[model samples]
Target chain A: MFEIKDLKASIEEKDILNGLSLTIKPGEIHAIMGPNGSGKSTLAKVISGHPDFEDPEGDIKLDGKDILDLEPDERANEGVFLAFQYPVDIPGVNNSEFLRMAYNAKQKYQNQPEIDPFDFESLIKEKLTVLNMKEAFLSRPVNHGFSGGEKKRNEILQMLMLDPRVVILDETDSGLDIDSLKQVSDAINHFKSENKMILIITHYQRLLNHIVPDTVHIMADGKITKSGDKSLALTLEDQGYDAFKDNQS
Target chain B: MLSKTTNPKTMELETLQKQARDAFNTLGFPTKRHENWLYWTPDNEQKALERKFYEPSDSIKENDVILIKNGSLRSKPNNNNLTVSNDTHDYQNENLSFNLDSSSLSYLNTSECSEVITIRCRGIINEPLQIRLESDHTKDNSTVNTKVNLIVEEHSSITATFYHQQLGGAFNLTNTSFELVCKDNANVNISHVFKDNKSKAFFHSIIHMHEKSNCNHISYVTNSLLTRHDTNVTFYKEEASLNLKGINLLTGEEQFYNHLTINHKSKNCFCKQHFKTILDDKSISEFSGLVYVAKGSHEVDSQQMNQILLFSDSARALSRPQLKIDADDVQCAHGSTIGQLNPEEIHYIKSRGLTESEAKALLTYGFAEEIIEEIQDSHLKEALAQDIKETVRKIKS
Candidate 1:
């Protein structure tokens, strides 16, 4: 289970996440819908231990263990994954080599013996096929010149390869065309299991149609204002966030 | 003997030599006051310049190697398409076309040089040629200075690698220079490498491009105490282009200095000079590249970029990329970047589970690959790729 309690974070003396909290049990998909600057992205960054929020006042635990003191990479190895809203371009870094390094890192972190690089290639090819990404994508520099849709698919490719217990897709649907959206959603559904936890952070209800969530939460002013079943998302999408904002106020 | 002395060609050579002697005597050595030698002019180098070096006596003619030691040609190939000579000729086919006072060292080389070795190419060479410039010292001889001239005749093509190595005592100086000429419709590619450790060295290359000629020059300079490279290029005719690139890898307390002057003097010419330097430990890299376009040289294109990567906090980088455009229809741009490994790049790699140092090493290796992949010759490209890999590995550990 993934849980956040009283998460209070600030950036450059400005409050961003004020007493925000959520709990995600195993075998559940939760979608966070919110207006811009409602701390949705900040919440994801705080969970993953971004350096900007160095000493956030909160309790972030995974499987009943407090992980607030962990580094970003440590959090990643601890099954916390954040698909960035805007993926950074790392020029000159080969895609396959980067994935292999990431995979071996998690392996070494878990005290498991490192797999041979040759074996890792075959493993990555399987994941690439599932994501429908070409083999040439593995040779080019990581996200250096990739199109918008391609970068989103690359995020899914990483999720498939690492198989983290907690997957946080932050705006992974924006800027993606319909075909890419369905493809990515299908892969996410395929990866879903009873032992995994998924958090989908998006503004539109379109993505939720493909990867249906069990619960929907409306975030405002850095904290959850309302929580309900799937139909609540349809209500908010139909009436816009203004209706939800009036109700919250 | 009297006829040899009275020949007009000999007279012309003797007059030029006399002028070079006078020029060297007047210019002497550059000091801190010289704008071009500011950061590199230490008083101790003057002592090294005064050291005496004797001439080499042995010679060997090989198939594809031009081997030289202490200003003397030791080996050259015996081929019909290639001719190696040191002869004085008429103005129409003269080998020396650069200014004598391009640098003070060039003047000294001209005055003290016993003979000028010219390697001329008349047709396409199937295999790439190798120029081996080496330095050695014993009880009798301890210092050396050498230079060579390369000429690609009209409608000819050639590829060559110039490798300079120093294997002398810790306290020695090696000075060398070369002048290359690409005649009308000629094509040339050159790869230069310098590996001199714990010693001081200076190398200069003066290049001239004629009508429709093209030149690609790449340099790999590293592993030296104090290394200085001075390159001067002049586009003398229309439709000529010069693509110059280099990589300087410095570690420990090593220092490398680069200075270039690119002059686009004719219409429809192109000039590009890009250099990347990697510095680690307490090393330093200094670069100054200037691209000049004359007033009437319209439709000329020129670009200059200097990128420096520092692996340590104490490493220092100084860069100056200057452009002086006098043509209205020309396109010219210059940029300089001095940075450590990208922080975002580092974070992205680290988030994938790599430790900080491993991430840094991988980025460093990749930075080198982007430049090495541009070389056209496969053999040279592979060799440089391996060399840079080993160098980066050493830097990482």
Candidate 2:
């Protein structure tokens, strides 16, 4: 299970996530719909251990263990993965090499035998084929000159390779075209498992339409104001976030 | 310089040496007040200037390899097609001369140089001539003076590599002067690799390009200590092109300064200067290049740029990419960029489970790939790639 208990966070003394709480049991997909500044992305950053935010004040427990004290890499090694909203561009690092290094890092953390480049090659190629990325993509620098859709697909590729227990998708559908959105959603669906917990944070209900979340949460002023079945996303889509502005306590 | 007798050549050299000695006496050592000598923090490097001139062995065996150790000839194979001589008369093409007064070290080289090696190439040579410069570390706090002349005759094509070995003894000083002459329609490719000098080192090189000649040069610097380079390339005739680039990967208090001046004396020439620096720890580096196109040199094209990547907050990068154009109808552009490792980029890599140091090492290596891929020699490129991987691993360890 992945759980955030009253997650209170801030940036530069400005409160962003004020007492926000959510929980997703194993085999569940939770979609978070909110307005622009409603702390959805902040939730992702806090979970991924971004240094920009202030030291969070609540517990972020992964499988009953609080990970507030862990470094970003340690949290990642401990099965926390956040696919960024705006993926960074690493100008000179080869995509294949970066993926291999990330895989080996996980392997080393788990005290398992690390995979060499030659052995890891076929495994990554399989993921690349599944994502429909060309072979030339491996030779390019990681997201350096990639288009918007390519960057999103690269994030999905990373999630597939890392195989984390807790997956946080932060606005992975914004810059993607309709075709890319469907393809990336199909990839996420293919990656779903009964042992994993997925958190989908988005502004619209379009992504939820494809992924069909188990639950929908309406967030406002840094906290969740309402929670219900997947049909709640349809309601928010039809009525807009104005319906929840006055409902938060 | 058309004297057929050997005595006139000797006398000409002797008189030139006398003039150089007088010049050095009048100029002495440069101070911080001089514009060109600004970044020089003198740590008692006057010993090199005060050392007595040493005698050089003249037994010339023409080997493909010319080895010089502390201003003494170690090996020269006679089997190669190159003509190695002590004479400097025909070594120069029409009205060409080494700019000895450009730097104080050039004056020091002319005054104290005991031996001079001149290699003349007349045709296309596939094999690269190797000039290995090593330091004799048996003695403590020593000084060395060495010089070389390379002349490529008309319609000739040649390649050469000047390899500077790692100096590993008591701190000392060295002054070296190198000159190259390219005649009409000549093509020359040269590489200078300087590594781990234990003390102060000053090196100067002047290249004179004649009509329709093209020269490609690259300098690879790593692990240097208080080193300075003065490189000058002058276009003596029209339709010549000079491509010069340098990569300096420095760490741990190493200071490197490179001053490059490209002078276009004739019309219809192209010149380029691209330099990159990857600095770590508290190392310091500066790239000051000046491109001056004379009034009559119309239709000249030149480009200059410097990119610096610093790893530590204490590391400093100084860039001075200046241009002086007295002529109209020319194309020139110069700019510089100094940036640190992006934290967001670091977080993205860290989110993938790699440690911070590993992310840093990978990104830093990628930063230098732009220049590393520019190397035309495959073996050298592979070796350098491996070398940089090791160097990056040692950072913050």
Candidate 3:
């Protein structure tokens, strides 16, 4: 289980996540929907332990252990994965090589044996089929010259490869087209397991239609003002965040 | 009677050598005052003119490999279409005379070299020629001068690989000059691998191309204390093309300099030059390339690019790409870039699970792989790739 209690994070002396509290148990997919500047993405970043954020208050626990003090890679090794909204392009690093390194790092952290190149190749080739990616994509540099939809698919591709315990998808559906959206959603759905927890932070309710969440929370002004079942997302789609914003005040 | 029977070509070469010697005496060694040599200046302790010459004491008798030790050819392969001669005999081609006047180092090489090693290719040569230039391990501070002449006749194709290695740790000064001529419809490829010891090396090469000839020149430099390479190419006829590529990997306190000049003196010629360097520790690298398109040389395409990656705070790079176009219809472009590895890129790689050192090694290897991928010889390509990976490992550790 992943838990956050009164998490107040700031960057450059400006508070982005103000007294936010949430709990996600295994086998539950929760979606956080809010308007612009409502701190949804900041919450995801704080969960992933981004170094840009200053001293954060409260506790972020993974299986009852405080993880806020861990480095980004350390958090990742502890089964925390964040699919960045903007994937960085690293020229000259082959995608397959990068993926192998990442996978082996996690394996070593878990005290597991490293995967041989041939075995890793077979594993990645299987995952590539799930995302409908061509074999040539493995040879190209990481995220270099990739289209918007391709970059998103690559993020999900990484998610599948790592298979972390807590998966945070921050706006993974913003720039994706309908076809790519369907493909990415299918990949995410395929990765869902009974022991894994998913946090989807989005501005619109469109992505929730593809991968229906167990619960929906409406955030405004750096705080979650409303929480309910999946039908709340439908109501928000009909009434808009303005109705909730007025109610919060 | 012997004077009457003297070869006119040999007499002309003697006169040219005398002229070159006079010019060398007047110009002397280069200094910071010379515009073309502003970045490199010899130390006062190292005098180019007052050094002793040593004869070679080691030789390799391999069949496919020609070994040149201490400025003398010790072995050659027997082939029907190729000829190797140590003595200067009637090699005064017009192409050799066109591109040797740009630098005083070439003149010095011409003046001081005792014997010239000439390799002439006539018909199609099936095998690549491997030439190894090695210094004797006598533990003495001496200077060696070597001159090589390569001639490719019409309708022939050949590949040559030159490996330079030093066997001792003395203050060795090496001055090497190469004259490459490709006749009409000939195809030639030359690869130079410089893996010298802690010695100072100065190399000058002049290339001339005839009608419809194609030439490719590739050089790799690594592990030299102080090195400078001066290359000049001229298109003497129409429809010729040239491709020049180089890579330099420097670490520790090494210093490397490359100066390239490409002259398009004819119509419908093409040229491309790409050079990349990786500098680590407190090393420094410099590149200056110039492309000149003379008048009436229309329909010419040229491109020059130089890129450097600095891995340390003290590492430095200076790059200058200049183009001079006098022709009306031509396409020319030049670009140069010097930068360190991107932090965001490194973070991204690290976030994916690699350690900081592993991430850096991967990025550095990727930078040099661009030039290594273009090598046509699989054996050479594999060897270079292994060398680059080892270099990255050494830097990280």
lDDT of each: 0.82, 0.83, 0.82
Residues B10-64, candidate 3: write the lDDT tens digits. 3555565676677777777778888877877655424633463647425535367
TM-scores, in order shown?
0.90, 0.90, 0.91
Tens-digit lDDT string for candidate 2 (A79-149): 99999999998876788888888998999999998896777888888888778888899899999999988
Pairs that collide in candidate 3 are none
Q: How many backbone clashes does candidate 2 have?
A: 7
Error of 2 at B99 (Å): 2.2
In order of listing, the candidates' clash counts read 1, 7, 0
Worst lDDT run of 10 residues, candidate 3 chain B, spans B1-10
Decreasing DockQ order of the candidates: 2, 1, 3
lDDT string for model 1 (B182-271, tens) is 999999998888865556777888999899999999988888787888998989899998889998899988888999999888989988
DockQ of each: 0.57, 0.71, 0.53
Candidate 2 lDDT over B148-239, as tens digits, reads 78888889988788887636443567777788888899999888888877756778888998999988888888888777889988998999
Proportion of true contacts reproduced by candidate 3: 0.46
